[model samples]
Target: MSAVLRRSRKSPAKDGPAARRDIPPGMRPPPLEPMRNPGLSRARLLDMHRFLRLNRVLEDQLSALYRQGKIVGGLYSSLGQESISVGTACALEPGDLLAPMIRNIGSLLVRGVPPLSLFLQFLARHAAPTAGKDGTLHFDDPGRSIIGPISVLGTLIPVMTGAALAARMRGESRVALTYIGDGGTSTGDFHEGLNLAAVLGLPLVLVVENNGYAYSTPVDRQFAVDSLAERGPAYGIASESVDGTDVLAVYAATQRAAARGRGGGGPTLLECRAFRRRGHAEHDDMWYVPRDIVAAWEQRDPIDRFESFLVEQGHATKGDLRSVEENLAAELDETARQALGSPYPPPEETLRGVYAGGD
Candidate 1:
């Protein structure tokens, strides 16, 4: 994370004495326990670490560019919630579909989106997936089975549900995964989509990122239920809440959910409990969040926690992790330069793709 975006008052170690001091008693995370190996090979574990680091560092570079007035639109940072995206995405099979929200950029990377594509998209260069017409993650790669998110909240739930249904009809074993925020779960689309998926036993996994707030509204005000996972029972499907800060736990949960979907067990709802450490957008000042809460979550930073796990479990050394960071920094620097140098689409070219079969 960049210094410019680090608003937390203090950065405490994950298991240090000061870690939970500022956090509310009710909101405090449980004691840090040793994470069990999820049966991943040493190489795979290191790859997960690389993705986690890349997710954070890439956003840090974008945050810097946004501050310098280079990026075309608002940038959303998934700083503290990196684990959920990386963990869930890494569990997928080759042909599984992924529908990622604006904050789920890490998923795109895990699905093989080059960092250059993101930089170009954000920079609004002519080579971007949207051809410089749009400035956000409104582009998708069919080759990678990534469905770009629609701006309307909760809309992707139904879209991915349809995709899952289509795959089943075609006799393919592929599963579809999509995400929504805590506030988005209140949308009618969320209910309708999940209900349909349950009824038909479609291979769909819906991940609800319960990141404390939906924009500025806290989860408490958004729903009366004790936990979002409870809604799964109402729909007659399985549900579970996992520690979003723990990558291994999230990976395990997603693997089980994916397996259930593939085995004709219907959709599964996973509530990932994590906090959004930054504002909803780059322009918004996070005055709504209490400082102590942000401080507390910062100590549980997903990347930092994952790094510690890799070393403790003998999967990687400190030097190996440092090399990953250094290599990623260099790669991002080159990507930004290339994006900056790319030209924007010509005015006449804009009208060319606006309508089909009209030139």
Candidate 2:
């Protein structure tokens, strides 16, 4: 069996009776075992660290922008789930394709998307990826093999399955990876896409971010399955559940899944167990989530955990990490300034690219 499958079956029981017994009933699961280092080099580990920090910091800045009324649309904050985005994206090869959800901005950054582009996109600046036409994460960078997200949840599964099929037909060794939230997994598109991928043996990987609540609804009310990973076998695919807060574990699971897909083993369903610390969007106050759950997840903050790992393992010093953060803070400040200064699309150009050959 694959590592992902094995991990899913034998996950440690630390969170069940011992740690979280006094906590509320919903969203409680066994605590994740400490993930072994995946043997990443010092530089790569540092890069992962930077990506995790950048993901949080960038979102923090965007939240500030939203509060100041500078942003055009709803701002989604991936406050507590940075590892799921960064770790999985970092596991992909150069030619692999990934479709990022709204909260997976870290994946975009890991794929070399400049912070300025995100700021521009959110600010509705002219030079944004959508050319100021859309204010959300609806832009794609084909050059970097990053597919923009569709607004409908779970729809990207079929889109990415098709992309994987196209790559296979073209005789290219590429894998397509996409993500869905716990709520999205219940959608028809999720079932149809995963079924097709399983039947056709497409080089695809589906990451299910089971982040506690599906927009205020707890996991107990979402589905009857004890673990979402169980859904993989019903579709005849490999599946695994990992502590989404552990960046190394997430990276390792994705790496195995991607390798299996590339090696013609078809699709793998990866369930990343995490907690969404914020509301569905910035507008939400998350009144439904229990305070105890929030406090527990905050203690497992992915960035803080990874920072300690880097320092304890001698991969980086406190000063080194501090410098990385300082530099990133400076970069984001400049990027936000430039994006704010950019011009918006003129009225005449509103329909310029709306029709074919109109540009």
What are the lDDT scores of the predictions, listed in order? 0.86, 0.87
lDDT (Cα, tens digit) per residue for candidate 2, span 210-302? 888777566766787878999999999999999899999999999999999999999999999888999888776665566677888898899
Cα lDDT for residue 79, model 2?
Answer: 82
User: What are the root-mean-square deviations of the candidates from the true structure over C-alphas?
Assistant: 5.3, 8.4
The local lDDT score (0 to 100) that residue 274 gets in candidate 1 is 87
Q: TM-score for every candidate vs. truth?
A: 0.92, 0.92
Tens-place lDDT digits, model 1, residues 217-242: 77667887867899999999999988
Cα deviation of 294, candidate 2, in Å:
0.6
Candidate 1 lDDT (Cα, 0 to 1): 0.86
> Lowest summed-lDDT stretch of 10 residues in model 1?
17-26
